[model samples]
Target: MADFVKGLFGGQQPAKVAIPGDDDFADYAGAPEPTPAAISSYTDAAHLAQPTGALTARPYTAWYRVWERTSPEDFKLEMYILPFLFVLILVHVWGTRANRSKAKAWSKAHAPLLQQEFAQVGFREGEATSDDILREKKADEYSTYATGRQNVAFIDFKITLIKRFNPFMLLGEYLIPLFFESIPAPAERVEATAYVFDGNEAKHAPQYGSGDAKKVSNSSFDGFVFAIVHKDIMKRMREDRYDISLTTTRDHAKLPVWTAVMSESAEITDMMLTPELIKAIHDAGDSFEALIVTDQPIDQPKTLDDTKPKKRINLSLKLESTYTATLPLFQLFLRLPDHLATAAHFRPEALRRIKQTRDEQISKIRKLDDDEKAEERKVAADKQKRELRDQKLGRLSAEEQRKFLEKERERDSKKKMKRSTVKG
Candidate 1:
């Protein structure tokens, strides 16, 4: 007890630690090295300690591997992502169906009213047409409008009940809901040739086709112009927020009746909608109305050389302008009584004169085309002749070759002139 107390207080302690020369350390040195058989057994035991199910698997399958490694959080995230996408797809499809239904209902209600209007104007519905018919009509309208011919005073109205959507393009709509909303809306287009009529039904009988075909061509010659624009355009015009311009053609012979912006409130009378004016509309190219909303007056200072200031002058008061053409004016012309009145002044001689001029212009165009082609052929022939002359010139002097080429050119020019005069 006394010795233990002394050791606790930093006195001499008992020798429990082993030194290097001790019996315990010498006994570990006498132990033999492991034999080859023992080493092999140890290695096999280590290999056996690893999992057998991992190496000799139940099956080589992705499902098993994923099942083993997939975390709870990963599974939860996948559940969230899938439902989100599914809901988005459902919303898009539902919206599209609703739009289509709405458009169909709108068309059903409006078509009857439109048909009645056409009937009042002596335009009978010829036939129900398909997409093919629409394409052909569009092509024909383009050609007639471009050429200012082959068009007659018949109104063609088309209503598309439903518009189809592209699946892939529609998927992108979700990225921008407001801007990319797809609506299978009903749409309508009306095309008519405004012409002059002398009111002689027999004399101005349909010249193009007969029956259903006749209705498709120059059947109606009531001498009134009509245009029912797109709904969007009508809305813009109603609001007085559309771009409109009226400019003459490059030749300055034709004047535009209307351009981009059309108004139902234009004060122009039906008498103004003449055949000549309608022809101008057919010939006018696309143009925009530029409006200067407001302009301020300012003072200008005049200077005299470097000596002194001369005088202060008042600049001209600037003007603010806005341009628009209204549909009411056009719509008025479509009325039956107004139409008949407008046609009262038109003479059959006027129609004959217009057609004659158109025919003569077309003939000139054909002749010009032929002359251009002939000139191309002559140029090619001249090139070949020059090649042959070059080969022959190897035996002649420079002066002789030059003279021969000059004579050849003169002969070709004379021949071209003779041909042109004969054709003319």
Candidate 2:
């Protein structure tokens, strides 16, 4: 105890004193004293141990031996990754090829029907190539288009198909519909048609309207057409809301319910919607989405200053079922341009009013363009003046800059006075 206390406080070293059971405790704990041979074996076996002396070169077979001894469980997940990716890629390629085959078959089947109507028919199979995408903005991989006749400016018939083996589509089309009854399953196929014809007398700006067929009680007005014209056109046609002159109640009694008429007078409507056309509408039923006679541009211009687009009559329809029987309806629409030009003759008064409306729209567009240009010029002029003033100030001394600012203020005041005097 005295020696332990002296060791803590005093500088002198104390004599060593071992515990009585220290050797027995070490033996019971099973920790043997390390030997020179045992230490040398441990150092040689450890692959990661640093050399105390010079570094020695290891044989290449040593690395191979270490790799062979590694557990297979270490790389179980990585082994499956490449094979799974290859299978996914193969499925995508098969789906794409199948889609193209279906499109080709559809085009082959429908080519004969188009040939019957057109003198020179051309069929082009749809592709998702970069060139096709660049040529047509709305290019689809699964769609095929046919062009017929020279008079017909454009014809686009698109058939959209479900992407085969697509996981996302499988989830939406099958699994989601099973869980949610209200959510309808996606259609396997959908078809849409657009026909554009060049016309000589279609001078109106963009105008749009839509209507549907409805049954009425009266025999005379069995399929009463409920027409809704564009709001702007409606406003111009009728000055007072209370007035019944432009009302659909009397004007569209003979036409199908929900058929839109864009004309100020009913003369154009009566000329276009003949008995045959009405019969076709009734016959086509719900399959017929619309048979529009529009002169609007298919693609809108970026600027009002762009050259006026050509005038044409456009007919658009969307059908869920096959449109083989609807070929006659297409022919009817094809003949509409000639029917309006030759068969239907408008009154001189009506022609003058229509021309006037077109001229007004042209003038309005021109005014807007001019205003935009004037604003741009004004901004440019202001910027130029600011830059010149800045340059001048940069060249001038502090005192000179002060005098220059004063002179500028005086010139502005004089200009304001001159403008006021002119007004007075």
Candidate 3:
């Protein structure tokens, strides 16, 4: 008990008392060499000491090797690494290809889907389409609308579609939901052309086709030949909360009949059912069943009013300003109507004249360039001809050499045609 109490207070103090007086001093003074640590073999020793077994004195008959199996996390890490490495390769190869990659397939598929959705529920049911998107912009600044769609490509190996501006693009970019009735899938596009119309009517048409890209030859006319596929644009309007209102411009002289017909058209159709038309007649409460809208609201609820002078004046200050700004072009378009009607009838002659004008311009530029080069060569050749005269060889002037080259070119062209026929 005394020893136990001493050991607890100051660890094994008794070991010092057991040491011999001389040997204790020697042991403390002498230093021992550091032995190397044994490497772990995991193999069982001769008298096998199994981790989960009782110790045995008999020698081991066969070696028991322990295999360190891979953990669940190791497999998961490999799974993550392989796909990440594969996708990295695809992006480097596919993104910068000279031609657009297969991502266009999604563009082709989604364009029609968005088109159909926008076409449906787009405008008022019975309204005239003359006032399309452009007119709606004026009615109310707060009015939300489906604009247009654009397609763009971004890097990061992620080729997903993003929709902007137009809601149809949203449908077009991503896939349209399948619940909508089965419309045909959108078709593929082969080519697209921009109708590049500058002020020069003579050089209006420049056709691009499957030819030398750097120098495209002109076709008969400039018409964009994009993929000609059929897609539907549909819309459904809300029968409720619709009102018919007319905003008019008083200047009959300034307004074209077509423009006037379309100007107030969108608002007229914005809500076909006015507030008065949607009467609360439901027996179950203020719910609506049938609605009524009088053409004109008068002193009486049911009666149509015609006497009031409600002359709406849509101001022409801005419109007139724009016309005054481009009065010359506006007059040209006005005068163009009569000639345009005639132009449709004589398209072939117009095309020929336009072509002739373009060819003439190009030929003039070429002639000027060739003339400058010819003059420089002429000065050099005159010196050479004087040298040739000094020599004894039978001499011809530079002009004669030019004539000879032209004759040879013509002869070679004919001979080439003859050889092609023989080969055929």
lDDT pick, better of 2 and 3: 2
* Top candidate (TM-score): 2
Per-residue lDDT tens digits for candidate 1, residues 1-424, read 9988885676764535555568767656544467675456447765778787778767666776886777788788789999988876776676556544443443343344333444222222352212112222221121111111122233333322212233444444344455633432223222332332233233444543355443432222322112222333333332342111111111112334343222111222233445643443443222112111101111211211211111111101111121112122223323433334333244556335434533454566567668888999999999999898778978778899888879989999999999999999
- The residue ranges of model 1 lying beyond 4 angstroms of the native Cα positions read 1-68, 75-84, 114-269, 272-371, 374-378, 390-424
Order the candidate numbers by TM-score, best to worst.
2, 1, 3
* Candidate 3 TM-score, C-alpha based: 0.17
Best by lDDT: 2
lDDT of 2 at 195: 44
Return the candidate ranking by lDDT, descending.
2, 1, 3
Clashing pairs in 1: 263-325, 263-326, 263-327, 264-327
Cα lDDT tens digits, model 2, 1-424, are 9878975676465434556768656544533356675455545545557665536665457567867877878778878897888887887778766665555554554555555555434443432332231122121234434443333434555555555646566556877878975554554443434343333112211211112112211111001111233232244323332221223433356655644454444665676678887777656544454444433233333345432433344343433346654555566765554454454456776456545544565677788789999999999999999998899799999999999999999999999999999999
The lDDT of each candidate is 0.37, 0.50, 0.31
How many collisions per candidate? 4, 9, 12
> How many backbone collisions does model 2 have?
9
